[model samples]
Target: MLYTPAPLHIPDGFLSILVSVVCWAITIIVIGFAISKTNKALGEKQIPLMGVMAAFIFAAQMINFPVAGGTSGHLLGGALAAIVLGPWAGMLVMTAVIAVQALLFQDGGLLVMGANILNMGLVTAAIGYGLYRSVAGQSKTVKLTVVGIAAWLSVMAGALLTSLQLWLSGTSQLEIVIPAMLGVHALIGLGEALITVFALAFIIQTRPDLIGEGSESAKASRNWVFAGGIVSLLVVLLSPLASADPDGLERVAKDLGFLSVGQDAPYQVIPDYTVPFLGETALSTILAGVVGILVVGVIIVLIARGMKAKS
Candidate 1:
């Protein structure tokens, strides 16, 4: 193994059903908030983009980075979305992906949806976005170096919070979990930073028209082609990184004795969600990411066409 995996892949038992329910309720409220970010809110044009963003994150999530000791983790994508879409909309997109993974793919735990959202959705979309904006506000385009650094920092921060959540839930000792989770992720965060910078750069170059404020917001759709092309490339490049070791969460749980506590989710993916090959973590993640991006791109196009139809 290369590292310990801490990505949210198991079902919940570390916490109670009540916790999951509360998180789900919170997810719903956040989604509602996200929907309100659109120019027309729930208009037909926005629905497609919303759905597409969900799929994009879903796909992006499949590619996990090898952290310490060969342990692997997935991409959270909140930062990317928040950079492109606003935080509220980013939350909506991220929640959709997590929800689908839990219900359809059976990836994340049902009980820890709140934990999942907090770690991936809220942390990345809200906190990460806040930092990015603070450094390079919505009006400014950060140098790729600056964006990469920010992305890495944002990912590191999110991983730290995930560990904290585990500690708070009594799943693992905070002391041990904190270092184990943060240490590995700090490295993985670089991968995130590189990918994020690349993606943002491509988008800006191809669709400079689609990125920013009023006129920019109106033109953002024009850059969909460039964005879609980037998606295709990411899908192809993503499958090679899955590590063989259990992730940070699993390692901490096993070491800290919380592994025995979380309800065992039936392992569905062969080699489950960590292998990088065609059968293991890598192949599935790449496939999932490509599928997700296409799904989102198609949805966005449909929405655009629909809005034009309505107009």
Candidate 2:
């Protein structure tokens, strides 16, 4: 069976060429600015931080937790990334991760990569962080609450934008898709909130130096690197247990009878997140997960290092 590129992202045949082009245009514009801002904001030492963070996000997204109605959701990583790395840098990291997912891992559509990045990266980094900063204030307790709320709302906002894109593409009616998408994603959003809050809290406690202008000591940074390794290992070991149920968008598409509208791309290097020549096995999945994490980390590190050089 031909699968849509990513579980939650809008894929190939689901969107019209026009909608895809528009999404691409907007993504390009925003990413250009994101690159500029990240270059100016991040320093040489911070590159490794961003690199490990991207790897952690990539690995974390591999585990899909079960939700209601046989739907599942994974970490969108926008809110967590923004809170840790600052918004603009987070946006660039997400863009790189999504691009690698599509190009090398084939987790998302190559053609619709812009839309995937825009929805999952730009929207969350811009609107989600804005909401979080506005409401979080300075108190640590308030910040935690606001991050959770902002993370939940960011998932919903991304869902709403995706639904609107589908509606515009004539894949489904706005009224029908809107309610279905929002309803399923509401539960998914809760998962996002809880996970984001817990991760943020952990960082605050263990690596408070990583936040804001705080400096990370050599030991603390090493600990973070170790943590990233552990997270990646966990993703590889636990991904086999990820729920087999359809994710939020896939579930909505099935319910709305628009699932069949998805089109296969012209070519696939590693389609459906599966590694070719390995067959469908636990080993293959783990290998693919590891490969994706490494790819995302290496790409982001190279980008950051290149920028640091230029500066």
Using lDDT as the measure, the top candidate is: 2
Residue 51 displacement (Å), model 1: 1.3
Error of 2 at 132 (Å): 2.6
Worst 10 residues of 1 by lDDT: 235-244
Clash pairs of candidate 2?
none
Model 2: runs farther than 4 Å from truth?
1-6, 63-73, 135-137, 213-311
User: For residues 109-223, could you state the per-residue lDDT of candidate 2 as single tens digits?
Assistant: 8777888898888777664455454433267887788788778867776777787677656677655676677777778789888888888899899998777633334343333
Global lDDT scores for all candidate models: 0.58, 0.66
lDDT of 1 by residue, 60-101 (tens): 766766767766545667778877876667777777777777
Give all TM-scores, in the order shown.
0.59, 0.64
Global lDDT for candidate 2? 0.66
